[model samples]
Target: MSGRKTGALLVLVLLALLGACSPAPECSSHQDCPPGQLCLSNRCQPGSPADGAADAGADPGRDAGADPGSDGADAGADPAGDAGADAGADAGADTGADPGADAAGDTGADAGDEAADSGPGDCLDPDGDGYGTGTSCLGPDCAPDDAERHPGAPELCNGLDDDCDGVPDQGGVCPQANPYLWVFLLAGQSNMVGLGVNSELGGADASGVNNVHIFCDLSVHNDGNPHCLHWVTPLVPGFGVLPDRFGPELSFGRRLHELWPNRSLAIIKIAEGGTALADRWAARDGDLYQLLVQQVTTQMNDLHIAWSPRLVAFVWMQGESDACSSDTANAYYLNLRNFIQALRQDLGVDLLPITAGLIADQPMWPEAGKVRDATSLLADHLGPMDVVETTDLPRHPDDLAHYDTAGQLELGRRFAEAVNALLADRDWEFPGDFSRAQGDGFWRYQACQGASCSLLSWDLFRRYWKNASATVLIGDGWVQPAESQAAEISWWAPWDGRIQVTASAVLAASGGDGTMVSIFRNERLLAGPRPLTAGSGASFDLLLDVEQGQRLRFITDSGSTADGELDRTTWQITVHMSRVAGD
Candidate 1:
């Protein structure tokens, strides 16, 4: 029992007490734990990291007393038992919620996202016709049942059927056949001959035809043919320049075909530039009147195919030639009357319709005022005639006497519109009461050859023939008993200055009879209305003389046969006023 033995025993007891109270090894974090230990609450627990075993300090057998709630371990005094209880409590807390539930929620949210991405997609068709889903909706039928369905269409001249289907250019209802036939004779200077327009050798495919042929004496051989009257007879399609392509874009016949697709039509064109009003074409005994008669007769033969085609209309474009002579201007109306009479006698139809074109654009055209004044007077008297306004077009396109392609086309279209308007009405207003004494003077026509020729005033600027068979009106005039009648009108005007002339006609009826009317000015003889007649009536007007004159005369071959008494007997005339020196 000595002091050495006592000291050793005390040390042993102290060591054991210390070991019981000490905690497990310290660890910075779970990663700082050894291979077989886990860092729990900043201390290394005694257990394999893989098994999640309890620490040495948490061993149940090392507890001092049995715990009330501990599964099989002491709960008081022993730190190991307390540790095990804490571990169990944490495990229970973790078990209360499903660990996979949050993961499942994330997976479901992801699924939802995928579904949203897979929902309705875009609908469009490409590589189709220009009218596909992405482009304008062109189709086989231009007019669709639902216009809203085809929203991407350009409402312009794209020439596309803006509704989905097949072809482009498919349009509306087809045109019906027109019982009446309208024949327009277009003749003028370079503009009438068609210049500056791209020319070709193709032919037009018009819709309706009453077998009526077209006769033209246009320049053919030369690059710019001046005058070449070949193939004298009326030929199918036509002779001279084929208007289909070898002319300006505004081909009169072509436009007529489109405007009146179902109407029977025949056009006779004989125009030359630089030809004076007193040239052969103007002279009654010259080639102009003779050729016109021949061609008109040929047209009549074709018109007879389905009952002779009533000479419905005529167009005249000239004046630059005689514009230098004032006498020609005043005598224009008288000359025109002679032409109408000749046509009526030759054709044997009721009314020889006429529509005169006035020159007003190019200043290079001599005596434009005289031409305008004369034409204006004619319009004032001629009810059925159409005086188209050309002042709207550009002053010049290229040539001195010709309009551009666009201008020409527009001109043709306007002319067609005017004709259509006139055809709608039946009454013919003839130009008349023309007296060429001074610049705006009066002329007296004394009966010389057969009948007494004189002037009879009717409407404003209109005149009737007294004991005369044929007479010329500036505008349009109704012929008595339109059918089966003949009139030969001769005209003369004293000129001292400058003038210009234009002419046209209209057939009043077709189903019944026939009549004839001729026009003449000095030696110049323009177009003549062949022998035509009908129960109804017909009329005509002309600017056959575009010049200054002093005296004017008219001689007719037929007149008003009412109750066997010549009631209205007189010649109608219109003259452009000019106070120039010799005019």
Candidate 2:
């Protein structure tokens, strides 16, 4: 037979087999049957493919069964059909060997096919931690032990790798360290959490600073240690620590670095949005204060962060929270004083200076006089403390609180100013302001061995002169006393220089134990202390051409500590230096 005839016969055989397997049509309803088939009840009945005619009494299945081609017997029936039928029968006999083993009729594939389908013997290996021997389709690979899944254990607070092997919080558990680190605890309420923006601070081109790391609590009362930080009043306008972001501009510390240019700083911020001083930070006995303590302690412990070098200052930007509270402005001052004292105790610093942000001038705090008075009282009462006035900065519309990015940055700068001022005070040696000092040199006053008081080193100081707090005494009791011997020293302007030195101080001691001021040039005592009079500080200026290398010191001969305040002294000195040539 020609190949074409064989192909046609094979196609015919397939059609017959498919026709035999189809279900008999049932007639249920009129729509169930072909248009020509009448629905006796509700079943669909068979009909001709076209014209809606019924092929009555025709049987395709039976036709195929009776033909010699159907039983695989006729030579003209198509050998391909015969071959397929033989293959089916052979497959039935084995029930396992595949019929597609090979079209070329080779059984070599039998062993390979069996091997390819075989699974491991019985040994569990789930995560492929390697040494398992198993034989089951669902054996080791699909076993629970073979996989490392994130089950999200409940031991998030223990700070341990709770789930067995090596890592903690691996499976939906808390991460060994949350990727969202560098958190700033946002307390208070809307202000600290943020009231958002009227417009972008630096416009679309403005990029936010990450210096003030921010984190937040899940809810206001959430006990979970939040890793988010929310800034109080941002330094730059847009620099507040938000939900999952920080903005406005740079933070106080960032600006601090800019001003100092040589200091390392970190910010552990925690400002509440709508918190009040009396409510949020009352005392440890108070609910809000306790909450703050817990947060601060937990963060420090969990992250093992030490508050030093890094913890340069505490920024308190709260009065608004307490503005309308029962704590009157005076009470606010009292509470703030206690809070400051508590913070110092907790932080283990004798004088942890704080920079308090004053309520900006606006409608919310229209008459900020109270706020100012309260803050001023706190600053004055609190030792080594200062204030960052918001009076000069722009305020939000509500004016009750908050600022735009520019206002925020200015606030940050002010905060930084307070801090730098504190630092500068601590250094305490500059004659005038740091901004205007002559030749980068310091006038070191050394009271080494009684009568030898003198201006010594600038870059280095001997152990005896290393006392950063070098105060001069006038009298036996901080005033001129009878028969008291006062030590004085001085250094002449290297050239014919005019020094503008201003001294304003109070003599806390009694009697002849008073201080004296003097100037010396080339071994010639040009002038002597016109007595820094009792109870009042004195100032003196003498236009004398103290040549280079001239020496100066205070000399007193009328007071004795034998019957007066021992070491009765403390004089605050501030001196300004400039070239006579006026460069």
Candidate 3:
């Protein structure tokens, strides 16, 4: 036990003291702890109360030793209180026991994972408008309750955005402005029924023009045709009473389709043969006029089912029968006016333009000229009326009254020209020089036995020409003019010019010595003081210089016969005026 023995003993004592002062082994799990011990604050400690207190002071990582009466873990809360609170108290407080700390920590980690699993930006949407509520989600809805109040929806006339494009009712999805079909009404007599043979022109194919439609009033035929009272499309040859015949409508519709290829064009045609304006086709009730109205409205309703219809114009081509009788011819102008007015009223289009086709003159119809004159007067009376001359159109080979196929084709093209002029708001100029004098400066006169010579104005003349009597006597006795046999007419010159004024009169006498007929302008002699015998007719023309606003007058004189028998003589007179060239 010298120096070496003493050094070894000292070393052993120091090692023992160091071991006693050292910290307990740390653990993160129960498996990391010794047998019968628990892991707490990453350290292995005793499970029993006595052992727990003994080891608590033995490990400096824990608090100083607790008294036997106090709980060992609670006593460890004194020194290093925060450490004890976090490790011992808090762990136990979280799990209700120290052993349950790991379970509590694992439960907290599971809760965090659950919160992460649920989408962070996912928002609650109470309303199902394809858009979400709350600021946290994509496609945030401005209004959640209204389905129509969403984005990218159609905007309607309603105050809201139906199409949900930021702007309302102004974009591509907005309602169309004018969704209407342009409509035309074709009505009149045999000409309107289209007597031109369809085979002559090889017919037209309206089927190729998909937008043009037509509804013919076959009810007037009373033939039990299926399309009689219904609307039909693609106007073709069989529209008239005769299957081989067609009217101006075929070409007219084709031209219209060419003009408006994108829009729907509908034509409602109601016409019949031998219809006179004075009787069956008169504007008054109980006539074919009401039937025309009914047909038009019925077709309009049918058209409206697919698209709204706008009545653009009315085309009238008739008057042949009216020209057969002098009475009807005389009343033609007034009858036409009434018909147009009534038509406008019934159709609810006050300014509806009427394109009338003047009846052609026929040798069989002597009074046809009178009807033509009345039509001219009709044009003068109505502002929106236009007259298309058919006198120059070639007549059918078999029939003298109706137009031939080529003429009918031209007539249809003319009708289209007129319609286009009207729709384009352009002025329509008539074909000849007579068009300038249409409103005035033309007159027709007839005088009969025992009747006072009547000085009728244009309007009056058209109404009462037939009732005014005039008998033409053509053989050998002495004859005299009717009482007050002279009639006169006057008109103001529209421009300063030399106008060619012409007057013609047909005279008849029964064995008259002679009769003197005369014509004058502004009380100055212009024509005849010419003397003639029985059964004579003559014409006179004068070129006279006239100033603007100057008035001209026409006069006729017939001398007395030996017997004073005025009934034996009568006369008819016609006067025409035209502006001279280089005026």
Model 3 over residues 269-350: C-alpha lDDT tens digits? Answer: 8888788888887885636888898878777777656664667778999888888878888888888889887887676554
Per-candidate RMSD, Å: 43.6, 40.8, 44.5
Each candidate's lDDT (Cα)? Answer: 0.38, 0.39, 0.52
Off by over 4 Å in 2: 1-190, 196-199, 203-205, 208-250, 260-262, 301-310, 325-327, 362-367, 398-400, 429-562, 565-583
Give per-residue CA lDDT, model 2, range 358-430, as digits (tens). 7755556534567667887667545456776776766566653666556665665677777667544322222
| lDDT-superior candidate, 1 or 2 | 2
lDDT tens per residue, model 1, 1-583:
9999999999999999987788877854334555556555357665533222122222211112322223131112111111111111212212112111110000000011111222222111111111112121232212211121132332211112223232221343112212444456666555565543433222442222232345566533223433234322222222223333222213556666665555556666766556545555564664666666676667656655653244556666666665666777666665555554455445442133456667654566556667666666665544334577665654344554655545565666677676666543212112452332111112232323322223333432334333234333222333332112223332222212222222233344444333334443321122232233333222332222122111222323333332111212223333332221111
Candidate 3 residue-wise lDDT at 54 = 27
Q: Best candidate, lDDT-wise?
A: 3
Judged by whole-model lDDT over C-alpha atoms, candidate 1 comes out at: 0.38
Clashes per model (N, Cα, C within 3 A) = 124, 85, 16
Q: Using alpha carbons, what is the TM-score of model 2?
A: 0.40
- Provide the lDDT at 224 for model 3: 31
TM-score of each: 0.39, 0.40, 0.44
